[model samples]
Target: MTNRVYVVGVGLTKFEKPGRRADWDYPAMALESGTKALADAGIAYDKVEQAYAGYCYGDSCSGHRAVYGLGMTGIPVFNVNSNCSTGSSAMFLAAQAIRSGMADCTLAIGFEKMQPGSLGSTFDDREPPMQRHLLAMAELREIAFPPAPWMFGAAGLEHNEKYGSTPEHFVKIAAKNHRHSVHNPYAQFQDDYTEDQIKADKMVYAAAGLTRPMCSPTSDGSGAAILASERFVEDNDLAGQAIEIVGQSLVTDLPGTLDSASLITLVGADMSRTAAQRVYEQAQLGPEDIDVIELHDCFAPNELLTYEALGLAGEGEAHKLVDAGDTTYGGRWVVNPSGGLISKGHPLGATGLAQTAELTWQLRGLADKRQVAGAKVALAHNIGLGGSVVVTAYRPAER
Candidate 1:
């Protein structure tokens, strides 16, 4: 944060269910999204001094493959994967480059073309990265659910037990996100649903109150963002379009995560809280100053739990926020005006950048139908499971 960094442009594709878009490949998706981001910034790909590309299920050097179509300028391309937080990790690296005076212009790109249904481990031979997480869950409870859903679901259950939050709270989140998606053309699922319908949908993890409607589906899509230093923005006369990166922090799991033996810790609630606290401290702004947010709502409960983690609400009081309808358009802050991952589709690597795109639009007053009124400050949260969590705060550039 020594030097000012701004998001000069952002772009994302309409997320589609995996296999439904048979014609789309990672390279094509990356090319289209990257092109749009470059066009949005009114800059040529050759101007980019470095690039960070993120994906989970891609081979080595896939970052190069994805960016080669833009130009073979031979710029350094770093491949990144922090599980689901891949996109935000890429963005963080881009910001670091600018802050360190390494580059004035950098690109952060994330894309994923995933296999349908629940996410599973790609390798079978070695010890899985999630072994400790899985073991922690086993010691906590006996639940038969997919790895991702079960982990988040268990956190929901803990929230219910610790905070008196009910299934109704989680269901309300799903309903709100789905309703929000109705106006988001880029969402993978724009169909609206009532809370009753959301709760009644087929259960994925019943103990944790997770249903089909409450979970983000595997998707295929890409998102990209261009970051520039203050000098670059002024030199290029891009001030009008620049959104300042006021504060950002990335945190990983703590020893307490497993030692505490809490389901919430197992699912990154602590990492998110720690990261968000750091960002808020760095930005000299609290949650009250944020006008809009795009948090990682990979599952409904995670959204509810994140409400507390982000300081949007006090501990164990996130349910009250939902009860008061404070998380929607008419609420204190519009959380996930993009419909979130549950409705927007979680394309692994692309999700964090997609959240960035939505927040950028909101800060610039360009989000159109989903725009939050008078938005100036925005916050984004993206957490990866095997564990990394990034929290970033943004606002329109100062005149």
Candidate 2:
């Protein structure tokens, strides 16, 4: 029989502003999150045959620092940095290890201790990784804002020009995410915001119709997950608590990203679509099959663009889905039940695993107030610039 993988345990640190908890460094965050995952799994760290650590702003061999404190086991530890997708990429690797029978159990950890401010390049000596993307973005809109907001804002503007979506659509998505965060104790900004509040909350990039609240904050936090093969789960009596990873796909930018001059494409929209399609095909599922989602909402525009890309809506019809309240609770599919990056805090490394944690809770009926009732199938989409997108589908292991 082919190997089946399951996420037996997941844990997350409450996301906070960079300086809010000065004592919680990357290692601290990783240890807390990692140990919690091990405890949740009812297993010891030595059981983990391999480990992958994801971080964007840390030094080399940081994975060792994170895992060594948990156990001195000399298992292979791989450090990963794929910008925002760092966490999910690590998760993908861990799943591969189990699926390939390389290991019966593997750990994936992601954490980031960010500096307070808009995110910037850590290394100025080398050419910036996003330079080409920014250059392509400059051709579409004036480079007035910071790199991330500018690119996403331009994409929002293009959506308005191409489709009939208005600035209110983006504002509504921000409002929804902010409101969703109120129920997520782990979210950094758990307070709700009205559309007016979001619109008036200091325009970070006015030309692109982006307000401060619509952008994800720079956060310091960590998340970790333990993945095991079916044999490991059955042997260790973890079946009842496990959540199976049904399908997953990772895709990067194609040539059209630069040559097409589409801001949406420039922001990894095509990659998201490609990845989502692959996952759906692999799982024999469609957008309608999913009951909940935790998409990469690093910016409000990206969330809206992902609606169409993930097949939640048709081309140029995402606004209608937003208008009809299909992306929220009591709708067809509850998106960003974890408050997403906007409110949940986007610690670059922690985000993807956090998404996995949220879905695991939703699938297991562990999410208290944020739970999507009768949730059976869930989907997660995480994207990073330069650019890589990972889309994964999940179902309860018992099912």
lDDT per residue (tens digit) for residues 323-351 in model 2? 99999999999999999999999999999
TM-scores of the models, in the order given: 0.99, 0.99
Off by over 4 Å in 2: none
lDDT of 1 by residue, 1-399 (tens): 388999998989999999897899999999999999999999999999999999999999999999998899989999999999999999999999999999999999999999999998899999998888888888988867687888888889899999899988999999999999999999999999998898788999988768999999999999999999999999999999999999999999887787767888889989999999999999999999999999999999999999999999998999999999999999999999999999999999999999999999888888899999999899999999878999999998963
Q: Which residue pairs does candidate 1 place in steric collision?
A: none
**Which 10-residue window of candidate 2 scores lowest in summed lDDT?**
252-261
Clashing pairs in 2: none
The TM-score, computed over Cα atoms with residue i paired to residue i, of candidate 2 is 0.99
Query: Which residue ranges in model 1 land beyond 4 Å of their true spot?
Result: none
Work out candidate 2's RMSD over C-alphas: 0.9
Total backbone collisions for each predicted model: 0, 0
